[model samples]
Target: MSSSLRVSPFSHAEEIDFIQLVKITLQRKKLVAAITVSAGLIAVACAFLITPTYEVSSVLRPAAINELDALNRSEVYKLPPGEALTKVGASLESYETRLGFFRANPGFFKEFEAPGRTLEQSFEEFNRNSISLILPDPRKADSLSAYIKLEMTYPKGVDGVSILNGLVNYAIDTEREQIASDMRVIIKNRLTEIAGKLDAARANYEVDKEAKIASLSELDNLRRAQLQDERKALRAQLKTLRTDRVAQLDEAIGIAKSLGIRKPSTPSLLGDSERSPSNSVMRTEINNQQIPLYFMGVEALEAERNALMKRKSDDFTEGRIAQIAKELQLLEANREIEVLKSREKEDLFLAGVQPLRAEEARLRNLSIDMAGVKLVTIDRPAQEPLTPFKPKRLLVVVIGIILGFIVGCALAFIWAFIRNRQSFYRTLPISSSGAGATSLDGEPPRIS
Candidate 1:
């Protein structure tokens, strides 16, 4: 049983030889150098073809406390330096603010315009790529300083310095205007509130005045009615007294005529037995009883009755009637109600409104010119950069050379590998049956 070992090409294991590859790469140094030089030249050309971009930047810091003193002192609106700085930073980052600046200054942004892009599209691209708002990192210690950096990069022909400075100014102005507008709104609302309070107070005053007048008038009317009733009663009593006096005088006259008395006579003038038994119609036995009307002679009684009938008013006889008449007269005018109704300055009567009026006046006279107010302080204004930031020619050339050298070495190794494989195949011996020869060890040959 004699078996021959056959060595197939697939059965040979290949091993890497770095030293060989290095030798092959060195042998093809000229080709590597040529590729590197070509790549360097291409990089130079690319550097020249690319548009140079220049950057302009500005640093913003919090405004001084004195700069914002006026606004703070107004008491209507108060803004701190740190808060103002934050607002300015927010405005700088606002897309709407940038767009508004662009729209206002179309000539300054002319360079951003391209053939295929509209003005809006160009602005969008510029805003996205060229504009940068760098705020302090909150994680770092420097964040305590609270600074904002605004940067704008533009092509060579574009005025990046002017654009950056102008944008910063625009942002500051926009923030100032917004603050002023807010203040105005606050003042307006405050004034409106004060006015409403004043109106309410005035309305309330009017209502109170009317109520007081009605109360006083009603009181006067009630008092007058009472006095009128008293006066009527007194007058009726006086009239009844007059009528009773006339009746008594008439009876006394008749009795005096029946007794033949023609003048005033005392009871003692009558005879003791002729006292008419002390119970006659002209006299009374009871000591508490009033004197009889017949005691006066007929002539005197007739004269008294005539005088009573001739009297016009009993008011003079009664002092209370006179007082009641005076009181009624006074009630007819109601001086308190008259004074309340005739008042022209009703505001003076409203209590606790002095402070409100003073506040309203202060708000009305509030003179705040926000234009002069500084919202943010510029630490470093944008300056024209002499050198372009992009398209570093030397660095680009060096990188291109390195990449070309790497590619050239790879190509050299590949070519050397192909040549070695071909030479190995040619040197292998073939068998009589046109097959590969067998190894003497009866194992696959290792390829190195």
Candidate 2:
């Protein structure tokens, strides 16, 4: 026979120690309550200490007929509407632009002061706390749009409306002055370019006319010289021919005298000499043969000489040359007239530009008289706000109460965990058995 091992299912079913945990938490209730109440009260006090902020906002839109549009319409060139205003808005939005404005107006910094801090740091804080820009559409976000809203918040120490209005005026004037200056510069450059072109055209026209007249005059002089030379050569050849003919006639007369044939009607036909015509017949033949063809006799020569004289006189006459000169003069006059007309056109353009320049000058002083840019106020700053901007007292109190209860519960649970751990160690049992018996960590003996 052998002893068998017996196991009970109820041995593993220990009861939970919730009652002990409750007892430990109850023991530390006073400590948890003190911490919770102190935290809640401190949070409430801090909330009250924060200064309440007040807000004032204003809206602006482009004028129906702004100065920029009017200027563009009147001038030969056009500038986009609201361009200058948009640029001004951007500048006003810039950190540097604001800083510069603050620097210029040192009094503006009095309302915003952070002791022991540099001006720049104070200015940055002031901008963060006091200014905000509201864009209607995120997609079309630009200073160029007229639908931008500006909001300013300042402490009760300063007048928010006065400050905002003053800044708005400053922005408008600065932008107008800048645009006017640019317009003046553009007009000046255009005028300079036009004047240069006109002067160059006039110079070229004058030079061309003078060159053509000089060329034509030189050609006429060359033709006259050629005709004079030819006339001189013809007169010399006619004189030489007449002298040769006279010498031949005299030789024939001497031969007749030598033969002792005075007043002979004709030469006898000698058997030893060839027969020839008489001196009178030869003289008559000379007069009849080639003299008329070459010299045209004395009367004809005088008539030819007279004709040559007429030709020479006609050559010096200024009829055709005068006509050409008159034509050149007319052309030069027409060119001058054209130049004058072109100058008139330029002057007209400049005339249009002049008024614009004067308008620019006027705008430099930031006058509203000349149209360029205009700002219309949509909403003015509120004189008094209905409620404080932030730090709701009731909300702060509620948050503090809820946070205190949670913190109290957490402290109570932590106390329960520490107390239960100590009690559990105290209540643990120790076992004693025979040498051969196995401890709880060892294997149990087997039975068959």
Whole-model Cα lDDT of every candidate shown, in order = 0.84, 0.56
Candidate 2 deviant stretches above 4 angstroms:
1-50, 65-67, 82-85, 138-146, 223-372, 375-387, 391-448
At residue 297, give the lDDT of candidate 1.
84
Writing each residue's lDDT as its tens digit, candidate 2 over 1-448 gives: 5454433222343554778556655677786678768777977886677676667776666545544555666453354545544565665577876777667776766868668988888889877878877757757656564655777887656666666666666665666666667666766675566556656655665566567556655655665555555554555555555455545444544554455333323222221234454434333221233321222233433444445443423323334444544444544334443444455444343322455455545444532333335534344544556655656766776788678866876788777655544444334333332323433432333332
lDDT of 2 at 217: 55
| Per-residue alpha-carbon lDDT of candidate 1 for residues 43-73, written as tens digits (9 for 90 to 100) | 8888888899888899999999999999999
* Clash pairs, model 2 backbone: 67-371, 67-372, 67-373, 68-372, 68-373
Candidate 1 residues lying further than 4 Å off, grouped into runs, are: 1-42, 258-261, 265-295, 400-448
Worst 10 residues of 2 by lDDT: 284-293
How far out, in Å, is residue 53 in model 1? 1.5
* Best-performing candidate as measured by TM-score: 1
* Model 2 per-residue lDDT at 368: 31
